[model samples]
Target: MGINTLAFLLFFVFGITVFYLLPQRLKWPFLLLLSLSYISFKDIRGIVFIVLSSLSVFLGGRLFEKRNEPKDASFRKKILILTMIFNLGVLFFVKYVKPIYGAFSGKTPPELDKIPFFDSIIIPLGISYYTLQILSYLLDVYWGRQKAETNYGKLLLFTCYFPQMIQGPISRYGALSAEFFKEHRFKLHNLKFGLQLMLWGFFKKMVIADKVGPYVQRIFFSHKEPYGLTVVLGLIFYGIQLYCDFSGGIDVIRGVSECFDVKLAENFRQPYFSRSLGEFWRRWHITLGSWMKDYVFYPLSLSRPMAKFKKSLKKKVSRVTVNRIQIAICDIVVFLLVGYWHGAESIYWAWGLYNGIILAISALLTDVYAGWRKKLGVDPKRKLWDNLFIARTLVIVTVGWIFDCSKTALGSLNLLKNAFIISKTSFEPIVLNLVDWVEIAELIIFCAILFKVSRMKERGVVVREKIEALPFAVQVIIWVGMIQLVACFGRSSGEVGFMYANF
Candidate 1:
């Protein structure tokens, strides 16, 4: 079931209740059973996939731990390769096949009713996320960074923890495994903080993200030629909508884990405040970006071929330029893979390329930009310069969102062309027509609230702590008001699924 629904709430409630009541030793098994039961609602095959994948990784980890001698290094590498191929093969087969099949046949992928004996034949829940986790764990074991878990049950729980199975912050074995097995006594503070975070998530997803859905749909999904301003506005709305939806979901998941005294990693960090495309990625989807940096980017940069390429470039250019070129190549490759990670779509490729090019240019122009700023009497540390760069970065990011929102790469290119076409009609008429004046005002106010909170966070205000310190009645009022806001605004949106779930 979707994490936002009442059913999942009830499931979480029951699981947590039974969890703390049990003896310390039984906690892991109890949670394991609960996770299995929760996922089984999708279908039986999902359980099989989780079981087999877990087993494969478990075996791989064991092999690394057991055979990790200096002499058996090549065999350990073989084990790593085989494990990666098998798990990633499953993910590619289930997740990527449908897009390819659809392209050739011009029909939707066959569903459970059309196919036999495999109702859950679709990509098993969290395959994209958990596969990376498992891969990370296997790599760690092979590299001697961490020891593999001998306990299959603990490893299983680590792999399929229910809350993270939704949309993950992608927990690491070194960071999360100890937390998983630790005994947590029940605490009122934990419950209070967890519920508060979860409520905040509800407000973000239901009130803000879903509220702007129709405006975005109007432009992005329209059959008629879209207005230029309207398309740009739609892309802007989509960027906000996606951030709230994905980050909101992570908040809910983290909050749920918190109730059990488990701390999941934070996924976001005020990304809109970033002044560069590179900084924006570091803040937005922090876990995924960090994952690629650690597991993919660093290794690829330091690989033999890259080292050889660096040697060749060093002979042709200065050392500084060679380093910049090498880094740009790695950054571009990482972003291309990141884009493809979204889906097997050309539009996503364009989006990845767009970001990669911007980042590479930013790297290459560092000295030139610094000289220009110096010559122009621009202080890099001044607020005006920072604000200007932040706005510029937002505009660049929004343009990339056009590709993300479009159905195809060509459609995005057309939208970009149209955005600059400058039609005679003023944007005022289009804006007014999209919603009532009251809603238009409310939208501005809602965005203001979001911006104020995020800006405070950017300044390190510790908002939740401040709220906790307020008088009891004021705290209650705040909670009640937030719930009322969600109840009023959230109901009309019906069921709004998260945008990133497809990825």
Candidate 2:
């Protein structure tokens, strides 16, 4: 169910209620049972795949832990490699195979006709998320950062934790498992804080995202080719719709975990205020970016091949230049993988390559840019330059979104071509098609309010805590008003599915 919907709300309420009601010893099992039940709601195949995958990783972890001594390190590495191959192999077959198969064979391969329930089987919910989580867990064990869990049930619950099993701020084994296993006594403050976040999420999803959906649809899905302004509007609105939808869902996930006294990693950190594409990535999908940095980028960059390459460059360039080149290469590779992680489409690959190129150029030109800024007497710390950089970053990010939101690479290119050449100057009739002038004004007002809140957060103001310090009655009234406003204006385009959930 969509997290914003009543069904999920009820499910969460019941789950948390029973979780707290249970004795300490029964907590893990109860959660495991609940999680399995939740997965079963998606597909029976999902349960089987997740169980088998979890079991394999669990076995891999145990073996690695056993063989992880200095003498047995080689064998432990083999186990890690085998486990990664198996898990990633399963992920590929389930998720990517269909698209690859379609690209080659016009029709379904006749070979599949022999397998039992092959047609019925599909990629399960949270497969991408949980696969990464499991991989990270196993890797952490191998890296000696965390011990492998012997308790199958606890590991199972960790993998299938219902809240994060949807869209995730992907958790780490070392940081999250202890909180997962802890007994949480209900507290009024936790309840209030969690509910407040959840309410904000609902507001973002139902009121903001859903309201903008029609306009985005109109522009992107037009029968005739859309003009420059329409395409630009579509890109901007899609960015808003996507950010609010995905981040809002994360907020709901975090809030739900909070009610159980489990804290999730923060995913977004005022990404719109980011002054550079690199900084934007560091803020946006903070967990995934960090995960990639830890698991993929650092290892590859530090590999013997790269070390040799760096040594070769040492005689030709300054150490600072070498470091920049190394970082740029790693960043590009990570972003390419990040793009591939989004989907099995060429569009996604192009999107990743697009960002990679931009970042690479930015890195390579850092000296030139700095010198130019110095020549122009520009201080980056000054407000004007900071805001200019933020605006520039947003424009770059929005251009990237064209690739993300379009149907194909060529389609995105066409949209980009149109974006540069304005064909229509008047947008009144176009905006009127989806909404009235007054509603447009209201939308702008809502955006202003969201911007203000984001700016407050960017300044490191603890907004929720500030609210918490208010009088009890005033807090209640504020919360009640939030609920009432949502109830009055909230709308959903039937499914209410999160954009990232598809990934």
Each candidate: how many clashes?
0, 0
- Return the TM-score for each candidate structure: 0.96, 0.95
Off by over 4 Å in 2: 105-118, 424-432
Q: What are the runs in model 1 whose C-alpha is more than 4 Å off?
A: 104-120, 425-433
RMSD over all Cα atoms, model 1: 2.0
> Model 2, range 143-256, lDDT digits (tens) per residue?
888899998878787788888878887888878888878777879888878888888887778778878877787777766566667777889998998888888889888988
Query: Per-residue lDDT for 480 in model 1?
Result: 93
Q: lDDT at 122 for candidate 1?
A: 74
Candidate 2 global CA lDDT score: 0.84
Expressed as tens digits, the lDDT of each residue in 34-126 for candidate 1 is 888878876656888888888898999898888867999899889889999999999888887767666565655554326453434577888
What does each candidate score in C-alpha RMSD? 2.0, 2.5
Scanning candidate 2 in windows of ten residues, the lowest lDDT window is 106-115
Error of 2 at 26 (Å): 1.6
